[model samples]
Target: MASLTVQFTLRRYVARAYWTAVVMVSVFGTMAADVLHIGLGVPFAVSTPAFLSVPAAVFMLWYPSERTLSIHSIQTRRREAFRWAAALATFALGTAAGDLTATVG
Candidate 1:
């Protein structure tokens, strides 16, 4: 049916958007972490924990607002927004941690 076809297309579009967001956020997060150290002269020891707190705060807000952190519960627009925020925060945290480790070694 036409409705089914439309639904399938919409789902595909959403999936593509999600993936694109992930890639873009990852790149930006890495760049941000690098900038904090290279541009501002902030050491990794300071930046790492600063970056990590972002995700922790995001989850603290998201869980209270949505009542769940499970990926399977990301069905509504609000939930999707929370998911994206959390994803971005996590990417930023991971990038900072990786950079910190590389610098320490």
Candidate 2:
């Protein structure tokens, strides 16, 4: 959060700040999915599609409000917020799917 604030404010950390946020989101997302499967004893078959619905839901809301899901159209604060939400949801989806493949035997 700090990096994202400093990033858009300082005008010099655009890519680095965004990348930092993405990496952090990805790591935490993986941990979250892992907790559902390993910690809570959920199965990948159940969690993968469940996580998939999140991003799909995000897109459903985002598209109706913004009329377009293209990154090129993200020129407003609302759009940016939606973009981040989608990113977070998709990363969580990726984590679940990756684990499904890796652990399947």
Specify the highest-lDDT model's number: 2
Which portions of model 1 show Cα errors greater than 4 Å? 1-13
List, residue by residue over 1-105, the lDDT tens digit for candidate 1.
Answer: 232234334533466555656677677778888888899998888988998899888889989998899999777767766776777678777888988898798
- Model 1 lDDT, full chain set: 0.75
- Give the Cα RMSD of candidate 1: 6.4
The segments of candidate 2 whose C-alpha lies over 4 angstroms from its true place after superposition are 4-13
Please, what is the whole-model Cα lDDT of each candidate in the order they appear?
A: 0.75, 0.81
Q: Total clashes, candidate 1?
A: 0
lDDT of 2 by residue, 65-90 (tens): 99999998777778777887787778
Q: What C-alpha root-mean-square deviation, in Å, does candidate 2 show against the real structure?
A: 2.2
RMSD of each: 6.4, 2.2
